[model samples]
Structures are given as structure tokens and as C-alpha cells.
Target: MQNFFPAQYSTLSAAALKDYLIKVYQLDPSTTCRLLIRNVSDTYILENQTQKYIFKIYRDAHRKCDEIEAELELLNILKAEGNSVSYPITDVAGKQIQQFNAIEGIRNGVLFSFAEGKVILDLDSAHLTQLGRDIAKLHQTTSSLKLNNPRPVFSFETTLFEPLKDLKPHFSEMIEEYEYLSNIADKVVKKFEEFDTSKFNYGYCHYDFFPKNFHFDEAGKITFFDFDFAGQGYLINDLMSFLNHYFFHQLNNLISREQAEKDFNTFINAYQQVRPLTDDELKAIPYLGITFHIFFLKFFYDNYDDWSNAFLTPRYTKHRVTLIKKWEEMYCNF
Candidate 1:
């Protein structure tokens, strides 16, 4: 028998939460607080008499002071450049980063200006093109600004090495599949080591650049949030992350592969307008696509419990393998 323990989350009373907000952050006492989502972090909707704000409480030990500050610094840069983003709000004390002991043992809290607009369901050519342009602008700006606080590097170790370490044990019974994946992961790591990434532009990037992470109003304006996965890494990783998600949806039959291909072309073409990808960066995309596959494999391990009923089973292994094979066939050859 194995011992399985569910994670326990600390809670705060409504009164206590309101008091903390008013006293610590100096918000209006009459403000109404409501829970939003409690997945990676505990997010809340903070509504005052006139305005709204996003209250994010980092999970215990999930992030440190420097990492949060790094994100805020990047946001400040984006805001200063007249880029539309969910800028972090300064408290009454003029401090944006606030950490204090709360329902969670020790949580880091940040307040962000509420972003207006809604998720785009219908992706028109113009919408997709504008998105690509905005992404290019983001990359161009961040490429020049230097961050004093270190953002975690999204490299082979975090995405592949650590993930394979945790996963090999879970699926050890399937010797052939496990070993095959192990070899593929090893090759990806070797590629990372051999490639001179300096040839391609690299900078602070949102590793989770997907549609759900931002908002698009009618005028094609974008207000992005959720810097939880933001880190210093190759810019291509961001593009591939979006592509991987779209490709996964395509595989699931939610969208046609042709549509996915069109989106990819549209995004890349628009991106080229502001900051073009070099021939070297384009060549590196396939290898990075393999890295994307490795990232996807690790997601199944982390979220298996959440999707076990729907897909994470023996089918999960086959699904991962199929994705790897599919990427290899589609990209590696090109």
C-alpha cells in the first residue's frame, strides 16, 4: 500500500481578508473581495466602489521576492513604452511587491491594474496578425532592457532533465516507451548544449504565450496577464509554446491542422514585420519543438491526476509518443 496525501491549502476568513487588504495594501475598506481561481496561485477579484483590481497570492515557496520583482520590473518597462499590459499597482506605501504571513503560511501578494477586454474565441486573420505584431513588440522591448533580479532560466534542466527524472519512475512498468522517451530527452539536451544560442536573440519571455493568458478588445488591443511562467529564455520558446498548444488542439480535432498551419504562418509573418527571425532562429525552431514536446510530456505528469479520467492512461503514453513522432515527422525533417 502507498501513502497518498492531498495538499492542504490555508484559508482566511472574509473579514480577515478585507482587513488585511485595507490595512496592509491600504485599499478602500468597503471594497468587496471575491475568489477567482485557486490553481497555481490564489487569485481574487478586488472590486472597489468604482474600479477593479487583480489580487494574486503566490503559493507558499512557489516564488521568491526577486522573481516577483523581476516580473514587475518587466511590466513597468512594458507600461513605460506605452505597451498595453496589466501593470502592477503600487500600494499606499509606494511598494508594488508586498509579502506577509496570511492564510497560507507565508504568501507573496501583488496587485495589478485590471485589464479590460475578453478572450478572443473567433481568431480572424486580422486578430491573429495583430497578435503576432504585439508579440514581436514585446520581444523587441524586453531584448534591450536588463533585469537586475534574475528570472529563472527555462533551459534543458528545468524542462527536460528534472521532468524525466520524476516521470521515468511513474511509468517504469512500460520499459520500451520509457526508454525511448529517455533517449529522445537525452538528444534534446545534447542539442541544447551544442547549439550556440547567442546567434539567435534571447531575452525575458513569457513561456506560456497562449490565447487564454491575455485579453483582446474589439480594436485588436491586447492586455496580457499571468507572468507566473515568465522567465529569461530563448524568444522562440514563447512562439513554440503557442504553436504547441494550437497543435495539441488540432490533434484533439478541436481545430483542423490546416487552420493551425494558417495561424502559425500568420503569426510568424506578422512577427517578422517588427522583429524578424533570422535563418538560424528558423532552423532552431524544430529542435525547440522537440523541447516543446518534452515540456508537454512533463505536463501530463504534473496534471495526470486532473485528466486521468479523460485521457491520462495507457493512452497518455501513446498520445505523447504520437506527438513526438508527429513533431519529428513534421518539423525535424524540415
Candidate 2:
């Protein structure tokens, strides 16, 4: 007998997953399972004649067991509060997480109720308003509670400082870009010191609220998914991420800056109708936006081995830094 060779990452077979799920979750035997996406994690779509489901297998490097449990707990809470989120589904054993030992190591998977809609990129006024209200309603639950399982926390330390330190090795070749990030991060910290953060609303933010993470049915109902980046931070972090959609839209000339502002205002107004935001919190969004960019830059660097090596080249790194500079010029006062 020969020994099996070790692997860093392995793709699980869809046919095998279909069989396992059918047996464990009591899914229809006729259901088909196909890989939907293979990124930081692997997403599979399983469906039969009557129902559809999403099974996500998380990379241990990206998300560990505790973090996955926390995410499931958050989704469970959101679903119970009547939020339109794709939530975890339990198997016949009443377990939401399924364990598998693959060639690499142990991988955790979860079956989620399929969100019934498609993504709407060019959102109209009605879509914007509904999205705002739904997000506010979701925040109502996320802001109030704490999870027993641990998840990442977004803060000056985690998002700004730690990322900068961890990314130094990756940025060794691009000293100017690294300096720009460090200087801007310092400015962001100084700017935050100026604000009376005691009034800032704190909670678990969706952290990645771009239009692509959500879907809208023909009836215009919005369902948000992909909580992979959800964490404790300023609740306004969610709002800032939504604003990023408009920022990119204006940059790419998809929408005029005037209209982007008007559209964002519509979303803000609807959000305020449901939940009140302080003036200081609104003022801090752009600065928080800086941290968002730097955090993700480090993320790309850290996950380059598992993700794309060619995607995070010196040119890409410089481009990201340039975008951060442009963001500062457009929005920041300091």
C-alpha cells in the first residue's frame, strides 16, 4: 500500500458532497450539487425540483471552527429577528456545521437556505430605500447582542495598526506605497481622536455591504448574504461600505457625482427613518473608509498563497495605494 500525499488545499468532490448531504440532511435524492465559486472558500449550489440550498466549505486558514460558529449564531439571530438573510440549515442531527477530513485537513461546511433573488447593481431609488431600511432593521439586532463564540473585531488596532505591521514584509519592494499607507493611517488615527467617539454607534457590522453581496427579487425584496467579514465595529462601517459602491460608480463614470450623492442621501434618509445616527458618526465614515482599504490590502497579502499570486503584484499594490490617495483627496479634510 502507498501513502497519500499531503496537500495545502483540496477541492471536495461535488458528487460525494451530494451523496453525503442527501444522507445527512435528508435532501432529495434527485438534488444536484455543483460548485458555484472557489475562492477563500468553496460555494456549492444544491437544488431539487422544489427547493435550493447553498453549501459553503470554509478554508481553515480563512475561518476556523469558532469563527464559523459565531457567524452561524449571528445569522440565526438575524433570521429570528425577521431579517431577510440567508441562514444556516441544520441536518437530521440538528447540527448546522458538517465536518470533513480531506487531503489537506479538517474542513467545516454549512448548508444555507438559498436567497431567492438576483443581484441588482444599478439600484433605483426604491431599491436604495428598501436596502437602507432593511439594513437598519438588521442593525437593530446586531448592535444589541454579543456572541459566545469568538470572531474578529474591527478597530484601530485590528484594521489599521496590525495590518500595517503584518504587511510590511509584502510592501518591502514598494517603500513609497508603504509609507503612504502608514502616513494616512496615522492621519486617520489622529482624526478619530478629534471625534467624540462615545456617541458612535457600535455593533457587529456587515463590513462588506456592497450591492453584490445582496439580492433583489422581482417584488424588490432585498436579501443580504456573505457574512464572511462581519465583525464588531462601528455600525456605520456597514454604511461606509455601501458608500464605497457610489464612490467607485463615480470613479468609473457609471454615475455622476451629483447623482451618486443624491442616491446616497436617499439611502441615508431611509436609514435614519429607522435608526438615528449621530453627526460625529456620519463625519467619521470617510476616515473609516481609509482603514477599510488598508485592511483589505493586508488581507490580499496574507492570503496570496491560497488566493491569486498574480493578483497582488507590485503594480496592483501601487494601484491600491493610489486609490487610497484619491479617496483621501476626495473625502478627507485632514
Report lDDT per candidate.
0.76, 0.93
The list of candidate 1 runs beyond 4 A from truth reads 1-8, 13-15, 23-30, 189-196, 296-326
| TM-scores, all models, native as reference | 0.85, 0.98
Off by over 4 Å in 2: none
Q: Global CA lDDT of candidate 2, please?
A: 0.93
Worst 10 residues of 1 by lDDT: 3-12
The most accurate candidate by TM-score is: 2
- Alpha-carbon RMSD of each model: 4.4, 1.0
Clashing pairs in model 2, backbone N/Cα/C closer than 3 A: none
Task: Kindly list the per-residue Cα lDDT of model 2 for residues 1-334, writing each as its tens digit.
Answer: 7777988888999999999999999998999999999888999999999999999999999999999999999999999999999999999999999999999899999999998899988988999999999999999999899999988899999999999999998888889888989999999999999889999888899999999899999999988999999999999999999989988988898999889989999999999999999889889998899999988988888788877558689899888888898889888999
lDDT of 1: 0.76
